[model samples]
Target: MQPLSSVQYQFPLQSLNTFGIAAHAHAYLRVTNTEQLIGVYADAHWRALPRLVLGGGSNVLLTGDFSGLVLHLALEGKQVVGGNETHHFVRAAAGENWHAFVQWTLAQGLGGLENLSLIPGTVGASPIQNIGAYGLEIKDVLHCVTVFDPRDGITRTMNAAACGFAYRDSVFKREAGRDLVILDVTFALPRSWQPNLRYAELAQAVAEQGYAVPTAQQVADTVIAIRRRKLPDPAVIGNAGSFFKNPVVSRAQCAALLERFPALVHHAQPDGSEKLAAGWLIDQCGWKGRNLGAAGVYPKQALVLVNNGGATGAEVVALAQAIQADVMAKYGVALEAEPVFV
Candidate 1:
């Protein structure tokens, strides 16, 4: 087993999370390969301790100093496994940057991921969230997921169907998923690429750009452009992409809300439910560009809550709670946080 002494103590985590909150971990380790990961689990010193498995640290909000072992997966390798002339199979380890992987696939002439460009986080974390943007979701292209089950010291692959994907949710987010660590993810890309412009904003953007039929590259560029205009960059100002999921409500509830606020933005879902824009709800509640202490709602997008510099995790949580309360009182819908709290 690897030496437990290699674990860093009282590690500062301000730079690790996107929120830029001041936090620390009791212990930390960077596992670069499955052997190293196994070594960590085998070590008696760390075996009984509480553990936090983190990826790019984009999808998490650190509430405070954690009294547990923080494991950062850094495993790296990627390849085109096998495919016929019409399709190709691409795979990447957990540590791979998600955007870079998307670009690499585009470089190889693959096109399904164009709409999901510029999303922050790692490849392994993608399947867990079933991350989606523009009009495409990872579930649309994911072929399989390989995970290391620490409980039995076994690694296995689960196909796309078995991943149980939903809108920004999967088996990986449930209780049964805690013991499994994602090792790598495989995607099925089609050689006969098609650009997706299902989202009205995206379709309008492409049309405004004077393209009746945009290529994959053009679609990706448009998506990045839209995101930049709508979301705060984690590098410049600290924030997770979106603070809340769009609230899905029954048709009767949506109609009731529309009666009160005729300008409410909503989308009809396949299941007959209506999805109300969480950002719009927050904005309507006058939370945009507002703050509770140092944590504030992003001016450009009400969906994002930002650290206006020197904000504590508690302050961010406070702002989120305030917004949730106001939105709930006004609209009778509870806003669910998008990021994982640790």
Candidate 2:
């Protein structure tokens, strides 16, 4: 067993988080294996303190220094465990980089995760947020999630149905499953590969690129190109990708809004609900390229909030609040931030 003495005090976290907020943890442990998790939870002194399980740190905003024990999940590995008639089963550790994992799957001739290419964070965080992009969500390909429960000191596997996935939400984010730490995720990629070009932009881009019948790798490449043109790389400029979820509203509400704002951008869900484009709402509120303090809305994509330079978590939160307030005032629709504020 690794000793608790491996834990460090007041660990700096500016580089860990994509937002680049200068925050520190009271105690930090770089967990390279499951034994580290068990060790931390078994110790009474460590267990008494609040805990924050961190992955690639792309999906979190550190508003201030965390007083809890930061368990930085660095576990890594991925492989094709098995395959059936219709799908190929692949398993990846929670700490594996998401985009790299998706690329690895494609490199192995798998197809289901192509549309989700270029998404940030780790595989473990994928199920928690049900991360989606272009036209695919993690729930669409996730077969099962392995989680460790500190309460019982037991590891268990839960299927997709048990995850309770909705738009950018899962049981992992709720009270019932919050205490369970993710270990790994297994994805059932289709054996009979097909390109998922459901989004018009992706389809159009593929067409423009002269790929009438695109392969999974080609589709992934296109998605990657599109993302690079719109989103800022965290290494160059700090950001948490899309800052808000596209708010879903009832059909009638959509119709009413459409009547008033004919140019409103929305998509009709299969469930008869309307999903409005959060970027469009924020843009209409006249927030594009606007800055409050060191935080600013990305001029190219209003859905993204960027750190102009050395932005504090409070500055980002304040900017998000202002955008939310503006959208609510003009469109009567509330915008919800996507990142977990820690």
- The prediction achieving the highest lDDT against the true structure is 2
- RMSD per candidate (Å) reads 1.2, 1.2
Q: Which ten residues in a row have the lowest lDDT in candidate 1?
A: 1-10
Off by more than 4 A, model 2: 1-3
What is the lDDT for 91 in model 2? 99
- The lDDT for every candidate, in the order shown, is 0.90, 0.93
Query: Residue 28: error of model 1 in Å?
Result: 0.6
Q: Clashes in each model (backbone N, CA, C under 3 Å)? A: 0, 0
Per-candidate TM equals 0.97, 0.98
Per residue, candidate 2 scores C-alpha lDDT tens digits across 248-305 of 9999999999999999999999999999999999998899999999999999999999
Q: How many backbone clashes does candidate 2 have?
A: 0
Top-TM-score structure, candidate number:
2
